[model samples]
Target: MNIEWFLVLSALLFTVGLIGVIVRRNPVVILLCLELMLSAGALALLAFSRMLGNQDGQVFVLIVLVVAACEVVVGLGLVVAMYRRRLPLDVDEMKELKG
Candidate 1:
C-alpha cells in the first residue's frame, strides 16, 4: 500500500506504546510498552525498505528482532527478581539500577 499509510500506522503504534510507558506503573507493563515501541520502529523500517526495494531494511528488522528478544529476556529476569524479593512491580523503584 501507500508509504504514508505504513508510516501512519507505525506512528499510531508508537504513540500507544508511549502512552503505556507513561501511564503504567508496573515494570512488566513498561517492558511490554517498550517492546511495542520497538516493534513499531521495526515495522516502519520494513515498510520503508519494501517501498525502496532494498534488502537492508529487512536486515535491520532482523537485528531489531534479536535486540527485542534480548530485551525481553533481561527485562523479565529483572521483573521476576523483583517479585521474588516481595517488591512491588513499580517501575519507579527501578531507579536503584542507576548506580
Candidate 2:
C-alpha cells in the first residue's frame, strides 16, 4: 500500500471531522465529530509507525483509546446532565454549566 495515500486519507478524514465540529451546533454531534478526528489521528500515527517499523506508535494508540473512552464518558455525562435540566442539546444553550 502507498503510504502517501494513507496520509492523504487520514488528512481528509480529519478535515471532515474538523469541519463537522465547527459547523454542527449539537453537543452530541460535536462529540461524534471529535471521535472522528481522534480516529483519523490514530490512523495516521499507525500508518507512519508501520512504515518506520516501530511499535511505539502502536502503544500510543492504546493511550489514545483510553483517552477517547474517557472523553466519551465525560461528554456523555455532561450531555445527560444537560438533559436532566430539560435543556436543549444545542451547544450554545449550555451556558449554565460554564464557570
10: Cα error in model 2, Å:
0.6
Residues 1-97 of candidate 1 have per-residue lDDT tens digits of: 7999989999999999999999999888889999999999999998999999999999999999999999999999988887898876776766656
- Which numbered prediction scores highest in TM-score against the true structure? 2
lDDT, model 2, position 45 = 95
Worst 10 residues of 2 by lDDT: 89-98
Report, for every candidate in turn, its global Cα lDDT versus the true structure. 0.91, 0.93
Clashing pairs for model 2 are none
Residue 84 local lDDT, model 1: 90
What TM-score does each of the candidates earn? 0.92, 0.95
The C-alpha stretches of model 1 lying farther than 4 A from their native spots are 93-98
